[model samples]
Target: VLRLYHAKNVYYRIMRQNVLLLERKPEIPPSKRAHTGKVAVGESNQRWCFDGFEFSCDNGEKLRVTFTLDCCDREAIDWAASTGGYDNSTVQDVMLRSVEKRFGDRLPDTPVQWLTDNGSAYTAHETRKFARELNLEPCTTAVSSPQSNGMAERFVKTMKEYYIAFMPKPEVRTALRNLAAAFTHHNENHPHS
Candidate 1:
């Protein structure tokens, strides 16, 4: 096994050297913006970050879960699961649910800033229009910079660690049920200290 491993490493090294000698370096595009560091949340519900997380079930089916987090309290404001893929319609649904959860049926007089990554669904024109109608100021993080939307990213990581990672993998439905329970637990019971 050791001899085979050494032989494989040497072969890959030689192949990499040959490839590098023959291929020219590709040009890279300049980043759209610089890193602006963490976003400060002045108060609860002032700014919300939304993102999509993907998980796989035991049977190899994939599910995309969309969720919104309140920046000030790190609470899971709202979430939705879909096996049909996330698009403008799903994004709109999550936003509407979040708005309703916060302000009931009436829209807030002050628009809340909705921070998210530059996903196609979030960037779609219809989604933008709907957000405006709901009194939300849609804001996208810098291109190629997930850290700009770190709060949501962090919550996704925590969810995977504490909940999704331990879920039984037999069925996507079971995973979804567990995920919903985990989200509720994190929002209502998990301490943020």
Candidate 2:
């Protein structure tokens, strides 16, 4: 046989303190939707992944970058780099540039998926609205989960290993210039298997 005791009584004895002094709090619920697992698409422009990365220069100046990549072709479509923190304006600029690069003056014929993590810039109300206006669907990864956006994460790894590792980044101007070349080379020369 078992005896049931009030929560307060059990807590008071276990903690050796007055249970009446303790206050219970409600918990935040989890999302109803499931996490996005695979980050690949069958065709180009069907989906694009966005992510930001940062590195420091030889002089100890930090450079941050935001980039968009086509899921199917794995092409680094457009990017923006700055010495400032990642912000909504920078994300919007990259979105506009990526659209211009892929579809020119006209927007995409169909809405393209814009997958990213739940970063403030990507999740800002203005940013989502702007993406909708541009014929893009902004979708964020699961909270505090990076693996859901694996393609972009892998791209960051490749860039850090192949390009940023050896490129001369003595200053911001030079680093930005090199970054442009790196993006071009990534699209044109680097092969993805």
Candidate 3:
């Protein structure tokens, strides 16, 4: 009644060849709609988004930064800095703290309707549990589409362009901090629309 394709099967080999020639891969019918990014139509911050970006230290080491932002005002609600030792815990902690900072005693009632992303970090069981504990919804973006998480992606691009890209790599954390401080001033004070 059904056919299965294993590694050594002719069907599998043919499928692999087709995949190599095709730029896009297949998805489940249920996920087909997300491929068009129709899930969170017209959503923005407080309805949050999260992502991790990698950076290189001057010591030739790597670091990861996890950040969360409100979809409405585009404000960075929280962030955490970690090196090669990065994991889901850091992201959960920072996000929870951010929500707490924003809503305080009302944190429980805060409607964080969406934590939108395509990042694996945003899909982790721990991440989901944290969001569930706080009553937030988890949403994934269309596969291979960065535009689904455009706001957070754009913020990252701006930070790298103005701070990281021009700096002397990652050994400049204090300088990076200063740049971030300046950026916060400009981001909140400059009246971006």
On TM-score, the stronger of 1 and 2 is 2
Candidate 2 — which residues are off by over 4 angstroms? 1-30, 33-35
lDDT of 1 by residue, 1-193 (tens): 9999999999889989888545767877765543254655878888889898998888989989888899888888888888878999989999999999999999978989888898999999999999999999988887767788998888888988888898776788788888888988898886553
The TM-score, computed over Cα atoms with residue i paired to residue i, of candidate 2 is: 0.84
Error of 1 at 47 (Å): 0.3
- Per-candidate alpha-carbon RMSD to the true structure: 7.2, 4.2, 8.4
Clashes of each: 1, 0, 7
Candidate 2 residue lDDT tens string, 125-184: 999999999999988888857778999999999899999998999999999888888888
Please, what is the whole-model Cα lDDT of each candidate in the order they appear? Answer: 0.85, 0.89, 0.66
Best by TM-score: 2
Tens-place lDDT per residue, model 3, 68-102, is: 77767677777777665447788778778877877
Worst 10 residues of 1 by lDDT: 31-40
TM-score of every model? 0.80, 0.84, 0.70
lDDT of 3 at 173: 67
lDDT rank order: 2, 1, 3
Tell me model 3's lDDT, rounded to 2 decimals: 0.66
Task: Give the higher-lDDT candidate: 2 or 3.
Answer: 2
